[model samples]
Target: MFGVAGRISPGPIGFDVTMIAVDQPTVARHGLTIVADHTLGDAPDLDLVIVPGGITDAVERDDRVLAWLRDRARTPTIASVCTGAFVLAEAGLLTDQRVTTHWDDVDALRERFPALDVVDGPRWVRSGHVFTSAGISAGIDLALHLVGVLGGPDLAVETAHRMDYAWTPTIPEAPEGPQRGT
Candidate 1:
């Protein structure tokens, strides 16, 4: 399965692997299972690709995974969590498309990837085939959105309500999070 790099904590000088399981209460309630991997290089045929945020490092620029993501986009729907949007941005997938990312990464992400039409707000955002979220916890929100979109609003709502999470908005929310960002 394709996965994004992540860290549990962002600190003064360093951090640890924040790679987390792509689990959603709603998804789980539906008997879903999401595996965790360090990179997206393994899956050759993916129905969907998900990237999550963390530190900005060499891996983010890894041509191997980037190329893999680029190539995979032709078949499966692609998505990101938080700053993972940066990965897709670098791969040149966000061009001329409206997308959302973790509030903290918005400015720099926008400046770094001018082609992307980045918007502010919401715990999660979906533009066309590319889905993005606010932050770590927001990943769950993004997943629910996908469930809603792919499974139907009723399913989405049921999933959200089942998970005890709030429903996503049709429009995006204003960005809000930590003090530091792009």
Candidate 2:
């Protein structure tokens, strides 16, 4: 969905997106072969950074990846989906920030980074220049929101309409009391 979000073009609100990785010829968790067209050393100055989550442990253990993220944390916007929040937290970019991730990993995120204000039940959360989303599909919603912010609400709506997508702009309130573990 990162590709989809990056390709969203509603009139003049189009984005020029590029994919980068710590290494080339990486395999996705689902067995998809991803050829890294750009490495961190070759990345252009970026206005936005979106980190998609999978196999968080491996990403956390890669010093090169962590250093690259730490360098890019100063970008205009940085976002993560699902377990990608772990990467941001590990990079010290999420300290004292309210964020959310896949519901199943909320507790783990909080435990791993006690300084982070990990929110629950929100499809997405934005604190300063950082954004995070719940799970897979939620990343699209967060991207649309970013589109609205970067382009305009009209363009975002147009993009969603063109894609036949249902966009939810508001975060719903979580039910009171203790939440069950996923």
Candidate 3:
């Protein structure tokens, strides 16, 4: 999704993305080995921080990662994909906020973070500067939404078009709670 943002015509959307990890040579759940660009201590200040979802039980237990997230909470935007919401909640960043996760794990998120308003259905939810999305593909939608917010609607549309993705322009509005983001 972000690849589309960095490869648009006329000019690329300006974003210098960095991948950080608690440790180098991290292996994903599916046996994918990822060599991170930086460790938490070495990462530069970021305007936006995105936490990806997968098997996060281990991450939820890592105090170092949680502490790093807490320290980076002052970033302009913090987002999570799927069950990555659990990590954010564990770090106390989702307190008193409405959030979402993979539909299969919605109950778990609600149970674990009783203080949060765990809503289901929306492809993504944006409360204040924190954003949460449902499942893997929803992260793409959230990414596009962020591109629209950080860049422009037109740029987002163009990026979507370039990627051949059917992008939805509006965020679903819930009957109660804050207005869904544009």
CA lDDT of each prediction against the hidden true structure: 0.58, 0.77, 0.83
Model 1 lDDT tens row, 46-130:
4556776776455477777678777867543567888888888777777778877888788987898787778888776666656
Q: On TM-score, who's better, 1 or 2?
A: 2
After TM-score superposition, what is the CA distance of residue 56 in candidate 2 from its true location, in Å?
1.1
Candidate 2 lDDT, 1-182, residue by residue in tens: 32443466434444667789887877889889898769888988777888888678989888888899999877877899989999988888889889999999999999989888999999899888788999988988887777667655655676677778888654323312221100
lDDT measured at residue 182 in model 3 versus the true structure, 0 to 100: 16
TM-score of 2: 0.86
lDDT of 1: 0.58
- Lowest-scoring 10 consecutive residues by lDDT in candidate 2? 173-182
Residue 130 of model 2 has an lDDT of 84
lDDT against true structure, model 3:
0.83
> How far does residue 84 in candidate 2 sit from its true spot (Å)?
0.6
Candidate topping TM-score: 3
Residue 3 Cα positional deviation in candidate 1, in Å, after optimal superposition: 15
lDDT of 3 by residue, 6-102 (tens): 5562453466668999998889888999998899989887777899999999999999999999998878778999999999999989998889999
